[model samples]
Target: MGKEFRCGYGKFEVKKMLKNYLLFGLVALFAGLSLRAYAADDKFYSAEQKIVELKEEFNLPSLSVAIGLNNRLAFARAVGYSDIEKDLEANTDTQYSVGSLSKPMTGLAVARLVATGKLDLRQPVSDYLERPQYTSKFSIAKLAAHTAGVPHDTPERDLAEFIDVKDHQRPMDAFYVFDKHPLLFEPGTGQHYSSNGYILLSAVIEEASSKGYVDYLSSEVWDRLGMKATELDTSFAGQESEATYYSSVNKEGLHVRSLDKRDRSFLFGGGGFISTPTDLVRMAQATYGVGYLSVEALQALSMPVKLRSGEINEEKYSLGWRVASVKLGKDDKSWLALHHGGVTDNAATAYLLVVPECKASIAFATNYVPGQFWRMRGRITSILKEYIDIQSCDRWSFAQSSVDA
Candidate 1:
């Protein structure tokens, strides 16, 4: 009877051990499959792939892009030819005219002055300059927001030549083109895309800072951001490492020629600066990241201004930036984005978008092909959104833990 009881107990123990081993094996297999799935989900587009795609799709002579995450540059790539004639390859350090994208940098300069009590956003431009020909209560804030009732470039006028005198040696000299022109509407009554308004802002910056416009921007904005490669687009002649501008308008549609004729100094605060994609990304990260600008100053630079009638500005022009909500992915909710773009006559285009919610920023530049700014932005934003989504994935956390382990 004792032997029979012992045999039955042993049989029960063997069955229990077999069941336990099967369960453990299943669990191990499931975990391995889960890890593989997570790694697949973590896959992201490489910078090289993105630039190559953009270059092919746009037929761009040269394209550059940079992405910033957590206030640091995460990716930068340049593809195609800087100068097709010279067979020079574009690179992250290659400089291109950033066009109206210069406004944000100018806006930052203003914010710095506001932070230091050197300038007032609410004060009238008349306060800084001598009595002007056109009398109106146009404030510095309105100028920055493009709501100061200034007219845009007129088709009949060659303001570029008039403003670019002496090869843009004097940025304030641009004011001569529109200083006497009458305001298009009452100040604060409406918004207009006015490069001339920024020219006026540049004048005010000079007066308040007691420094040359470019000099102030260099010391206060570029130097502070550690943007060593950025500088005003003064001239193409004798400029080294600068991408030779091109256009697609020639006879063969592929006959790329230098389009660096315009004196960008005339654009001044509006569009005179030239920089690499990485440098622009660095600037965006610094401006939008904490500890760079005061909370109040950032608000002034990012918040959309209201008209005198309390109506919201339709363009969403917030100081130098265009504030709007961008839908990042097909299923994701729209996210607020502070962005700007610049298109120049020399076929140079620049676009910058900063997603403050994700602490992500992207800047892109093309040496040729203006007017496709939004398309380029969409592609870059999509890549960034995918990366951000991957970072937010639970699998990413697990993967990071494993890496840490």
Candidate 2:
């Protein structure tokens, strides 16, 4: 066996070859992996460290941030507990009520439908509804843009009624809550934020597609983008992995008992979806993507409503998105950014900011309002900038133009 195992070369030659092989192995190992290892070590680790510190600094029950860079999700993380009392830790998959972020998603859907000739932005609300509740003077575009005269919320519900919702009603049920009320302002004359306006938009979606609003949105938009985790927020009991929304201020954290399980289905078109940050990022990219939404669709959704004075709506509201001009560098020219923020009184704080110039989208949600939107925005923006340099970005607001900043 020893004789059979002997090499054809002498021991000296064998040793030399073995040494050469060892050197080559070492060279390949270092040369092939060193750059990648350094890049990850510098970028990914730095981002992780900052994100962790941000959670502790804010004392949030949970925080999830996802970023799409260069047209793909490059960074995503969830920090803290999704359920603080159950001690359930939040992961990237944790679902929080996305609140008004749902509006832009609806807007994106409307854009696609318009491009495909399935829907029309200029069509009146009467054109889509089985029984048009409002005057036909206003167009679907105005409704989607929140320039429609629709009231901002259900006038039928008292504070108690709003807080104690416990039904899994149809999308049309929302109309009964506000359709009886008069318009807040003359349609297309002004901008008034209205979840009810989007409810009308949802009715339009349902009527135009001959399918339920959620069904059409899920199949056509969310499911197509691989956003399986997003869905209309309902008051069903014990939804798996749902975060308990807290409004009380406590550094230690709010308990499960203090939260209410309200139904969000009433605003399904505007502020009623539970989603993960990753899914929001996906939705943002898809909204900006040409493959999914044609150029005509993009233009239809991108036009900010101009007031009777021929000025852009003071809120800069464009379709479902609130947009602004932003510049990443002092020397850089500004570009349009599409963004929206959502807050459900006791549910969560959510924001989606899409910057097409850099092909980057940032989506973040906190289970509770952290009470420091500007601080959070700056830090999150910095983190993304550090990881991937962005020359320009679109914008989002946390509140009305004055408060949202």
Candidate 3:
């Protein structure tokens, strides 16, 4: 009976069903494509518009920018107030803390020592600290990568013990915290973002290379790269022309202050270095070429690490960078992009994709609200992703474009 009815059904009924199905499929396909294309085109823009929009949106009192296209300055702009209280404007000369972006410079210091055969990246921290068995498993490499099982910060017990006992006359020596606390885990077994790790490595560099962290940073990294305005600890109290940092207020606006007055002594090599945005972009570009690290060392600087979760993800820390890739598209059509961010208690900063081949680089820095440098970085990063082409910002292509044009 069923077979007979099916056979009796008109060809029109079958044709109508097929037509509806095909139409539905086509609509779904087009909708998917449209959504994807919108997401991709939605994120990119000319640098000028993005700069204008960001300043207005953030109510940035002042901002300074220097763009390197093909590793050369294609454009440089400064707008708003560097000092709102004094009615001062920020310029390329205005210095901002690159914050933990300083980590990469620390990494370069380590790499420079390695280049000169003065230190080994794989050597154990115990080799230099005189405690081989306890930290034997942790290497110089793990410290730079932040995978050495150190705490995210110096231990709280140490902070409570040390904060008031010694004032300026006593001098700052926060490295003592590591001496008091036990290792969090066996080094290299997991990855954690640790300021303490870099601090310890600072000591290690001092011991291994026989140069203090600041001296090594100057002679080997900053001065060599021609980062003239950059300094360690010199700008802690505030400067005449630099923009004062502001912390964000949850209910309304930003509360501003000076990074110079903050207790920056505790930061040491991990997060203490200060620099302007222009100086940052210049020195950072040096790492991309043979003038700095060898190609192998540069690759090592971006190598990804495994975390405690056992996931093989890209966001792992490498020498001085957080090695992660981003995609701008909803599907596989997007390009892979790399990014990193940094912050001090009074400021936040970032360095994004450098296509050394394009000779283009995108770097940014912002003053934190009165007490919110920590949160400002995430906010700034979110703001940046809205406009940045994580792939196209590469410097090499910018260079080639300059010549071709």
Candidate 4:
């Protein structure tokens, strides 16, 4: 259901709106709307209409979004072409590569292992394997928080090279990309975003569980959540439900050009996964609402980066998610936000936002990433907020430290 806004019935464009308008009046009636009084142009669009608008505006080949409220998937929808040239329309199950969002899965996997006493955040990761030459040692917690001083990439090796890895890069093999480089700082001394750090985390997970990264996750998380459509960003092509990846949608003369064939497994624990909006929401529920994380476990994942010098990292990053204070709706009050955004070398993008206060979570995904994904993100968020009626946050508290930290 959607909120009531002032709009003229005659001015509603049937072609642009999603679904048939056959029962628009009846639907409005149930939604507590009487469109008799307001002007035409002042009308607010529903989530469906706005999804179409965002797809068109950003030239997204395919887009999907889902909302989880009160521990259930309340809304899920997808639109546009999964393959523009093939004209394959995307459905709610279509999977798009959600880059860095893989971090939380890794984080949760670590938490699961910790719960079983198979992993320890405070221990040196070197306990699992021999420390690589030139790399300063760091604990698992620091690595997850990006405070391990791991460099993003080795010198003379741009991250794009790793991003475009076409070879079957195993999590351990991926270490060569940054293991030889020096740390950005001493471990636990500072914060720096590092995809390579996740590579290390994956290695630790592998050692602790004695299982493959995807295998461990499947058995522990996805299977438990019924997220059957989620999987690693493998090199194998032609998966039935995976959306076509596009590096660029159009050029001067060509219409749909520049496909991106990436084997993102090099960054497996950090940025290697394709998932649907529905699956992402499923993940949000398990990670935040379900009995999956104990109080202390959730505290570990949400704990803000506190440097060795005692200064809080301004990014407010935790093990796998970002912790922040967000002011929602039209109110001036602030709410706790646990969230992450994903971008895959301009090929795809995704974002998942959790408003704990409302027990509400929203996920957005697209196959083709534009230069302005946030603009599309903002528009879709506004539309979904109205659709789900998330106007305030009262069920708010950090699993870790207070906002004042």
Candidate 5:
């Protein structure tokens, strides 16, 4: 009556077809299991569970995480609150000031420019800055690696003065900090962690690309990687999502308050980026692409030098990354890791990037600082270790009494 619907096949034939379909699906399922047995390994999930408990104990308002294993991001999650006052939950979109984690991003830009034949690692910085009157002693490589022989700037108002002058119409206003100081060394002769040295490199990026540092990062690197939640701008100031940095009145004292957030113009290339933890994990993979630099110029980005000496100083500087060796297993050889941390009195930010033999990358970021660095380091180290091993155990202890509001 209904135009003989399904007249082409009898009921018996339809049942047989459906049975075959289910049989094929079951076969595919078993094949998938066998494939995973050889390729996939559970590495970081257990560690992540412990970390969640730790964050709750610490009373952290928010936390965002991204973990990579077996050459892919195995897990990512956002927990707690981004805005404690509003009871807003933290999510992968929550952006935190990445602080010194900005270094590797700058290095990537330099590498991309190099690939395009737009930058030369060995070229003297004077060539880009037109500071020929000064001796052409150091090269761009040293500057990127922090072995530029430059000492940290010495002035109480260095940051304050730079912040005050950044918004001016004149271009020279931002360079006032360097104009006030003298060279620390002849460049490439020694190594020291100098934020000022990095700020200078941003100037080089601008000169080479004819673009502002922020614009370059946004369009060239971050946007291209689809890192929508990450940004380098001054707009985050006084925003609800931004974490209030808390530092003790004195280094050892328990009293604390929010540190004043300065204009991004002051930090420039050295350390002025806001990102969620998920974006940062994406960044790590982009930097280490399938056993090769994504582009030819990026190859030079990994060129490292001894940045420090002695038993504790194991890291070498490679472009904008701090490269180190880590032990992951008993019979397994050590893996190369890039690490860095940022401190602005009130905020403590640390990043550990372990590129295992299997090409897995692991990264972590935390907002609160307990005022004791050694204790903080221990906790951070434990979290990383747990992720590497996939073990379940409480690594950080935040007080439940303090966490409940």
Candidate 6:
């Protein structure tokens, strides 16, 4: 009886071991299939396919995009025609006017000066300007952050007149357009988005650096970032490689038109820069990472303006950037993103989004300017997040190292 019992127990143990082996094999097979599915989803072609669909849906004349991963530019693609009439294909090298994206570049220029002790954020801008026209105390930081209570836009009549002028190139020249306007409210008590404020900043940069705004940006920011293809958006008279501007004028999508006739000189430090997607991504990574501005200066660049009651500004205007939080995917958490977008009335539209959490950035520009372009921008972000993985880092500690000499 003891021998029979031992034999039965041994058989039971053998069956149990076989069941365990089968379960392990099934798990391994399932895991391999999951990985393959993930790999297929992550393919770059997936993004390209979406872009093609967007291009067709939007009826865009041209679209250029660059994606940066881990502080490195990982992908760039341009589609459609730069000049539809000539059938010139837009490529990665094509340059498009990056509207308000110029603001962050201007902000970076200011930060560079602050880093070298050439300018003070808290110092009154009147100290730097020769005329001293502001009625209330307005600091350089306030101007950079658009919290100086300056009017948001130049008077429509004045802007129209300025746009007609042919040769206004100096930053001070642009100042005449809005210098007569009174402050909308007490400086530092309110927040307003004023391109006029940045126009004044260009003058301040010139006065503080003893350099033309264009030359200073070219030398200090563009050259330093290796952005060889970037240049101020100017008259297209001699610009052969610049993308032709297109706008939707009726139910018909996309009509070719002359670029906005506004004198780029007057646009100055406001919204007058043209760049390729690759160059923009490079600039974003350089500014967000070490080697450009000190950590303190970067912090200042990112610090939101405050009202008199110590309440944060609603717009979240930090120097030249818009600081915000973005959710990457449904299951993923939201993260801080620094971004800016530009849209010319008759020309092109551009967007730059940088996520420090992932050390990734994406820049996009299109020759077409349809009212629905903003919707397309959202779709681009959604498609990109599908492939990009967000990685966490100790942001405070990383920022501290940038400040170290």
Off by over 4 Å in 2: 1-37, 130-133, 157-164, 250-257, 389-405
| Model 3 residue 12 distance off true place after TM-score fit, in angstroms | 67
Candidate 1 at residue 2, lDDT? 30
**How many clashes (backbone atoms < 3 Å, residues ≥3 apart in a chain or on different chains) does model 3 have?**
30
lDDT of 1 by residue, 171-207 (tens): 5566666766778888888888888778778877898
* Pairwise TM-score winner, candidates 1 and 4: 4
Give the whole-model CA lDDT for all candidates, comma-separated: 0.71, 0.71, 0.56, 0.70, 0.57, 0.73
Clashing pairs in 6: none
All predictions: root-mean-square deviation over Cα?
16.3, 11.9, 16.7, 6.0, 14.3, 14.5
Q: How far off is residue 364 in model 3, in Å?
A: 0.8
Model with the higher lDDT, candidate 4 or 6: 6
Model 4 per-residue lDDT tens digits across residues 59-110? 6667788888766777777876677667677789888888889987788888
Please report how far candidate 6 places residue 37 from its true position, in Å: 14
> Which tens-of-lDDT digit does each residue in 8-97 have in candidate 3?
122443456457655755776787757544443333323433554455555555555555444455445565556655656666677776
RMSD of 5: 14.3
Pairwise TM-score winner, candidates 5 and 6: 6
Against the true structure, what is each candidate's TM-score? 0.81, 0.83, 0.70, 0.84, 0.73, 0.83
Model 3 TM-score, 2 decimals:
0.70
Count of steric clashes across candidates, in order: 0, 4, 30, 0, 2, 0
Order the candidate numbers by TM-score, best to worst: 4, 2, 6, 1, 5, 3
**Which tens-of-lDDT digit does each residue in 87-137 have in candidate 2?**
577788888888889998898878778767898677787887755456486
lDDT of 4 at 388: 41
lDDT of 4 at 122: 76
Highest lDDT among the candidates is held by which one?
Answer: 6
